[model samples]
Target: MDTDAILALLDGQYLLILGAVLLIIALVAIIKLRGSVHQLGQEHDQLTRRLDTLWHDLDAMHQDDTPSLSGKSKAPTTSATPDTSPELLLAERRLFEGLWPVAWALHDKVGGFLRAVESGDPHSESRLAARNAALEMRSQINRSRPFFDAEIEGILTQLVDIEIKAHLTACQYLDQRQSNLGVSSEGSDVRESYRNKWRQLYDREANELINHLVSAMRKRLVRHVP
Candidate 1:
């Protein structure tokens, strides 16, 4: 072949090689981009699922209105044909009225924390509020006991257990939050372990408390049945 023809052939080969390299680079970039998109979709799915679970739990709490702790629906009447003494009826009313706010406060605080967990609020303010509310609830229950009958007092005592659980759960949550922050050279696995532990603890205690509040049913507190 002529020298000019050989040079032209070499240039063509070089162009082919350069095109192949560019094609390979483009394919690699596309593969990496696809992997990142897939990862993001998975993360989105997880977040949606977490939110759905949180809503389901919270909705369940809102659906139930009846209290569970009452021995029976037997509040004294106020008619001329009195079922119980005026003072006794007043005491029962007081117990019911006092407990109304406590149940709501528990629900609100518990719901707050669960939402916080879903939202990834590391400070966990909802759990902290729940802790303080629970302590205050115990105090209120104690202070109001003097006016309540012995049977009523027993029902209120169950709430004390729930309150203590709330307090302890709050402490665990605070610890977990700080530990997860990694100011102390914590590893990813260790932080993840603590996070999972705190989430499970909060869910269990919070759900338990919600169920227990059914014991403080409004119907039992008031006299609606003839």
Candidate 2:
């Protein structure tokens, strides 16, 4: 072939090769882009599901805070009964609102402390928090004594006592466990078993007491509704 013709042929081949390389690069980029888009879509779906779960949890909490009254519905009474006077009812409602959060706080704190003890690494922060919660609960009850009837007040006292006992028992368990960390003896096993039994018993009792307290409070509130 002529020199110019040969050079022209080589240039055409080079252009074809460059175009092929560019095409492959574009295809690879497209594939990678598709993968990134798919990954983002999956992440978006996961986040949306998490948000939905959070919303559901919040709604459930709201429902728990404001329980509906069960059974008989009577017409609103025209005159204020001595016990159900508007002022007294308002005060009782406020007390209920104030006490509810503190009660649950104490319950959660004690429960957390017990769980931490069971896990064999009870955090000091958890213990202190539980103790403070108990004290706060007692103080709150005492402060609101005027709003509570004798029955409710008694229930509150019982709840506080049981919670304190549970907290103390948990602390003792942790202390014993720490003191005997390297020891392995039959007596140790027996003591461990005994502690476990008491812990379980206290936890069960506390749960029951909390349920009873809640039911009593609900009934008290419902009773005075005009």
Which candidate number maximizes TM-score? 2
Model 1's C-alpha root-mean-square deviation from the true structure amounts to 13.6
Give per-model TM-scores: 0.44, 0.58
Residue 62 C-alpha lDDT in model 2: 25
Candidate 1, residue 222: the lDDT equals 48
Compared with the true structure, what per-residue lDDT tens digits does model 2 show for residues 38-149? Answer: 9999999998997576445434332332223231111222322237676877788788888889988988987887777777663778877877787688778768876677
Superposed by TM-score, candidate 1 places the C-alpha of residue 192 at a distance from the truth, in angstroms, of: 6.8
- Model 1 TM-score on a 0 to 1 scale: 0.44
lDDT for position 56 in model 1: 53
Instruction: Name the runs in model 2 displaced over 4 angstroms.
Output: 1-82, 180-182
- The C-alpha lDDT values of all candidates are 0.56, 0.68
Give the range of the ten consecutive residues with the poorest summed lDDT in model 1: 70-79
lDDT of 1: 0.56
| lDDT of candidate 1 over 98-175, digit per residue (tens) | 776785686567657655654667545676576556556666766776665444444445444433433444444455
How many steric overlaps are in each model, in order? Answer: 5, 0
